[model samples]
Target: MASESSVWNTCNYSRDVTFFYNLVGKKISEEWSTQDFVVIGLGLTVCLIVVLANLMVMAAILMNRRFHFPIYYLLGNMAAADLFAGIAYVNLMLNTGPWTRMLTKEQWYIRGALIDISLTASVANLLAVAVERHQTIITMQLHSNMTKRRVVLLIVCIWVTAIIMGLVPSTFWNCECDLDDCSTVAPLYSRRFLIFWAVLNLLTFFIMVAMYARIFIYVRYQSRATSEHTSEIRHNQTVVNLMKTISMVLGAFVICWTPGLMTLLLDGLLGKASHANSFEKYCLVIAECNSLVNPIIYSLRDNEMRRTFKWILCCLCRKGADQRRQPSVKINSPLSEETLDFVQKSEDRALRKPQDSHDKDGWTEPRV
Candidate 1:
């Protein structure tokens, strides 16, 4: 009973610490109920799908040399962010509900930090992609002139910003000294911080929308300007199509995350009166679904991304088949350079099957 009292003591609002009960409004036990089990089971299943889909996207971008441009690099970074979010969500699901009761304050902060990092990285990557596209399309260039080193530096800066954003809440912006400033949604976090974070992200969304709107307006003007060269018109069409695919990705992000961000903003402004708890779980679930939707959007909209996804699946299938079959036609050094050479040769042949149908980036152009 003394230990239980100590645990309750640690949850003191005056000290800005949170007990799991503060969020859930219930007592926890060593055992979970059937409802808890089912909820966790479904959540884990969804998280697994999110992880695998994003992993496939990352692998496709990494392994395909054709997808090495600034835009593709940003997309790859976005995939990495989504993959990180998936892992974060899995961690949250595993440690949430009754399990949160067992967490130390430091552990709880780490969990929230992981999620914050993922969200910030995702938003930053989207902004980077938008900027890259606007630069390329405005100049009527097929791709930006960004060097590999510059792209790498840009990506590094993005992650650094995300880390700083994620750490700010626990390290500085927390309401440890004042209960009146504490957030309702995150009991240890400052309401001011939540308000700041939400408004910043919303402004970013608006900026990106304006940028894309400008790009489309420019493209429309170009299309109507009556270019005499066939090649120029074809180039414009390709850029337009790629921009449309990226717009779809941005649209998905906005649709999924806006509600959650709005809820957080209202919680910061109105405290308990916002009734954020009633909408919090639903908002979170919708936001989590966004990661799962991105890979599908890429597959459906971008021919190269779709083909790369298929190539990755086929390689996996071949490996599984090889594991199950006898080595009747196997050569020497099956685990060495010879095996890699054979696989590379096969992939090259598959990729080069189409003739005189390449895009600006050397990918086979999609049918009209």
Candidate 2:
């Protein structure tokens, strides 16, 4: 009887050990994958491109006087947000280990915070841009009142609001989750946050769409009612160009942001499954790709910007054409008697009419 009892205890111990070993082995097998390398490589490549492109956009706006306007200020803010997002993604890709290796708790927290901040900032800036455009189109008088100082204030407000949005999530929910290789966090998709963002996004999208639709409708009506005036035609063309620019910006925003929002909604409501990891990663990749897309769209669509970019590249290449394009020294030549007389007459005529400094700058001295 004693021998049988001892045998039964030994059998139970052996079964428990075997079960533990098999569980560990299954985990190890699941972690191992050849495709991790490719995914990381692609992620890094995308990050590098996005960072460089966004930086270029910021630099271009800052360095060029032509781009120094309220609209471009918003664009610069957008680029800055994108630049930060790209950097954060690069950090995430570098720190993320193979599936076999779990991410540290710190990494999880940091990534969540960074993603929340970057995404909120990017989307907020887009909304701000759209609002600015709506104001310009719907209330041209209000646009005329827009000043550099006011624009700076608007940008500051956007950053503050975005930070609040990001911080709210962190305050309400745990920002870190332990997962294999990478960390996952609960993004407290506040009903308030969701409703606010959705309304903003939809408002911007619809307003721009409606404005463009109205402009096209008006143009068609004018074209059918009477012969198009050259000035009217030029005005319509300018409106079309503006619409195209806004469309590109809106389109890129929708493409990059919608997937992530959808995924977030799914996770928040239904709880994401382990099998959905790949889909989540794909959504991230798509969102990050927007940082690269914005610069390309801007450069291709804006004529002045396209020319400036070309000139900059030519200068970098040390091309002869760039050298030949330098300003002529003859610009400083002394005016002839007749030219001087003409300038004096023009000055007298200008003094006769009340003029602002802006109008004064518009006038030029007669050429020699």
Candidate 3:
């Protein structure tokens, strides 16, 4: 028997968006079993991790002066976007879960807008990072001469374009269907809009692949410094590291987002979202999980990032053996004294070198 309040049976658009979905095949929150609650708990856990990890990266970047250059600048923007994405998942859980009736149209629209911003900003910032790396590598400049004004312009373009692409189209999501009983299930925009969005993502992905490929080829196959064995070896090593980083970034992006992206494409192609609600929900969760990935990749591979993270967090709590032990007049032996002096001298000389952050080529900035 159909529930009188169910959207499909009643043919009502005023009902909550969740009214149409068969929630995990159960009737309502009252009917959910222990396993359902467990699933909800796990989803919440993932969302929390995504937010905290990305926020940590953003905080580290903002507080540290060394990461002020273009690449790290782009990374900070990416982290901010991911952080927002993670927050959106919380809103999704509310809208799709038992509390869905509490969601308003404005809230739903904002949720959609946030997701769009997160995705587009992520893609744009990453592409910018790759392009910056390519520019520096091929030109043999440790850092590009990107001015502050140019960087601001790029940032503005990224956000503005993302808004137009992701949020503008959502304006049509009125959820109206039949005159008496309109529904939210219908696509607000045409199939072409969906295709266009997916195509833009694919286009960016392919461009990155091509850029990385060229960078690899140039670094591996051609080098004018071949006669200088040390220079050639160093150059090749730098390029290898760059390629590895890019590969990991691109790989994570594909792994995390491909499932939902494929679903979106199929929907556009078929004019229907054919997958089960459970399956589609999980696929989207997987895509949102990408929020925490780039920061993890960055912290593991970049020694400097690790230091910066530590530096940022250490102020909160300081724990060491120093407070436990009483100071004594312990004189250093002659050899120990000499070692200490040598270390101090080396550190002093290193401080004299401009731009503490740089690649092997002595650039003033570090790559993302």
Candidate 4:
């Protein structure tokens, strides 16, 4: 039976969004079953891993001065979205299954909105990254000349767009007044809204794919044209490798999310008879796994990211070992303050080289 609570019936426009489907056939058990417990345990475990892994990615980028460029900043933002996804999924898991039946309308809406925002942010951030890369690669630059202020503004705009998208279902389109129009997967949500959301994301995926395809074509042509210039060839090769890594990330996202989006589409079109809810659990699990896989892809496919991860991990280990051992006594410096100043100045000069010259880490900052 459809919930006829005042919350759902009071306002036709206030049904909130959710990325997951509710359990349809099962009654709320008074006691947690072994299966439910197992599911919760595994889900929480994965969420924790997702949180830590993404945290490490963000930390690595933030702590390393070499990673303070536009591309790395965008990547750090992606990690932030994944971190949010991990937190959102934890909330979903805690409130799902038996706990779902006990939640009030407001609580349900909050639960759903968290997941919606996280997912929308993830999708929006990916598109932003794609656009950023397109602008840079098309100009044969290693990174864009976007200033830190512009990057911050871009990030803010991404979250704002995501928040608007996440809330749109509840603000404008819902089935609260008409139960017949309600989705089986999300009783409070309008079928039209699901159809719209699914199609929109699918279109975004296609657009990103097209952008990457153009980037690859241009890079291939550039490589051939610059074959005689050894240094230029190396630069092109670096761009290709980075593009391949990012493409893997995009490919994994598409593979993991398409099924879930398709399920939403099917439910939106066919309603109750679609049997979409039966597969909803599986679909959501797969979708959630996408968040977990991004960090792995970054670590595996990017040499710089992998090296950063190792350095961070080693630092942590060394710190632990140092705490176990007695602190070393301070020794008087052999060099005077003037010598130290000269060394520092030399290092600063090396770091401040022109964009065309690579730094110690072999990272080149591209000029606009």
Lowest lDDT 10-residue stretch of candidate 1: 359-368
Q: List the residue pairs that clash in candidate 4.
A: none
Q: Candidate 3, residues 229-304: lDDT per residue as tens digits? A: 6545555555566457657877788788777766665555554334333366667878977887888887777655
For model 2, what is the C-alpha lDDT against the true structure?
Answer: 0.59
TM-score of 3: 0.74
Error of 1 at 236 (Å): 1.0
TM-scores, one per candidate: 0.83, 0.67, 0.74, 0.83
Residues 184-253, candidate 2: write the lDDT tens digits.
2132223344444445555655665566566546555654553455534443444446556766776887
List ranges where model 2 is wrong by over 4 Å. 1-32, 99-106, 139-144, 175-228, 273-275, 318-368
Model 3 accuracy (lDDT, Cα): 0.63
Question: Model 2 TM-score?
Answer: 0.67
User: Candidate 2, residue 253: CA error in Å?
Assistant: 1.3
Best by lDDT: 1
Q: Report the number of clashing residue pairs per model.
A: 0, 0, 1, 0
- Give the deviation of candidate 3 from the true structure as CA RMSD: 8.4
